[model samples]
Every structure is written in C-alpha cells, then in structure tokens.
Target: MNAPDRFELFLLQDGEKKITEKIFTGLSNTSDFILLKEDHTLGNLIAEHLKQAPHVLLAAYKIAHPNVPEVMIRVQTDGTITPRDALRQTCQTLVQMYFALGREFQKEFALRQFADQGDQGGAGNAGGQGGPY
Candidate 1:
C-alpha cells in the first residue's frame, strides 16, 4: 500500500468499555505528535522507551532545562558521561529502540479488508471460508 492507505486505530479502554478513534499513519506516528497532544499518554509512552537508553538521563536533563547549551556539557557536569560516550550511547539506544508496528498494522488492515469484502447480510466473520491473515 502507498502512504495514504496507511492508517491506525487507537483504542482507549476504561474498565469494560472501549473507545476507538482513527489516526492516519505518517509523521503523526512520531515524537512530534506526542509533543502536540495535551494528554500525557503519548509522552509517557515515549518516556518509557527513552528511559531504557543509557544517555536518556542526559536527554531528560536537557528536557528539564531547555535553555541549556550543549547537552554533552550538561550530561557531564552532573558527572558520569563523556561527550563521545553520550553520543555513542544515544545513537545505539535510538537504533535499538526502532519498533516495527507495520506487520501488526497490516494484519489489522487485512482483517478490516476481509470484513468489508464479506457479504453484508451475514454476521461478521461468518461468511468467509478463511481469512489470509
């Protein structure tokens, strides 16, 4: 599928109830969206992943003091990390943190596509012989 066809469903669950909303997949899937949302949910998700990286504490320091010059300086001033070490750790962490959700998204897309392809008069998932997922 091309970029335009990519989409995601965000499911919010509260106890037994589920609230679903659709979001387009694109730049919106990245950190910028998290920064835009007033809700802390997305920020928490990013923070959770970021916390796993060695130099994330330095990033957190930078976040806390946005006006600080040179993250490497701030990271070292507190003692522990060297400039080179922090850079290497940050890059390694980011590389390891890349999570591929496309396969799962495609599976969801396939199931939705399958549902749409089925006979409308029958119960959902009832008419199809089997889905390819």
Candidate 2:
C-alpha cells in the first residue's frame, strides 16, 4: 500500500484507499502495481515512461474489464533497479514533465498567441477546427 499521487488522488483513489502494489511470483525483476479507479491513459503514460527508462526491460499494463477502473501495470527492470523503483521513477519523471509543461503553457498563454508580434497563429483562427484535435 502507498499514498495516492496528486493526479491519482482525484481520478484513481477510493476515499482513503491508495494504490496497491504487488510483486508477482516466478518473474525476475517484475512487479505488478494495481491502480484503483484508474484508466488506460495513466497506465499507458506510466508504461511508456518505464519503457523509455534505461533500466526497464519490459513494461505493460492491463484492465481486467473496461467497466472496472482498476489498472494493473507490470514492470520489469534489469538488475540495475527494482520494478517498484522504476515505477516510482517514472511517476516522478511524469510529475516533473507535467509541471514543466504547465509552466511553459502559462508562459505561452501570457503572450496571448504572440498577438503583439503579429504572429496570430495564422488566418486569425489561432487554434480552431482546422487544426488537429
């Protein structure tokens, strides 16, 4: 058992119940993390980060059922780091990335689409239906 992450606190927590982590048997350097009330987005994000990590050998997740908000992530790392640690690291990295992204967004929004510079993001639409959704 572990405390819920800030993102998880809202989307994945069941009152005081936090995310549950379990180490699977017969699998070297592999562990399973159960994220209650979670979904594919968070699971995929974490798995992508773990896959990008140098120490991670394999990372994947599954939801037993679509209606169920439980995500089980399996992380396997090289001997360099434990599966739990890899997951933790991925979460920390994601938090940092989100913070940086927020800051950058604020800075960009403060510029108001660079209106003063006459770069109105083209055709005065800025970001409309013509752009990628």
Number of clashing pairs per prediction, in order: 0, 0
**What TM-score would each prediction reach against the true structure?**
0.29, 0.74
lDDT of 2 by residue, 16-133 (tens): 4446779887688889889887788998989878899889999999989986778899988887989988888889988888887777766666665565457634555453222111
Model 1, C-alpha of 40: deviation from truth (Å): 13
- Please report the candidate that would top TM-score against the real structure: 2
Give, for candidate 1, the lowest lDDT window spanning 10 residues. Answer: 29-38
Off by over 4 Å in 2: 1-16, 113-133
Residue 76 in candidate 1 has what lDDT? 23
lDDT of 2 at 94: 83
Name model 1 segments beyond 4 Å from true. 1-48, 54-58, 61-99, 121-133
Model 1's alpha-carbon lDDT is: 0.36
> Worst 10-residue stretch by lDDT in candidate 2?
124-133
Alpha carbon deviation, residue 51, candidate 1 (Å): 0.7
Per-residue lDDT tens digits for candidate 1, residues 1-133, read: 5552222123322442221122223322212111211233433433444455453343322222433211211222122544345534654654454332444556667876677767455556543333232
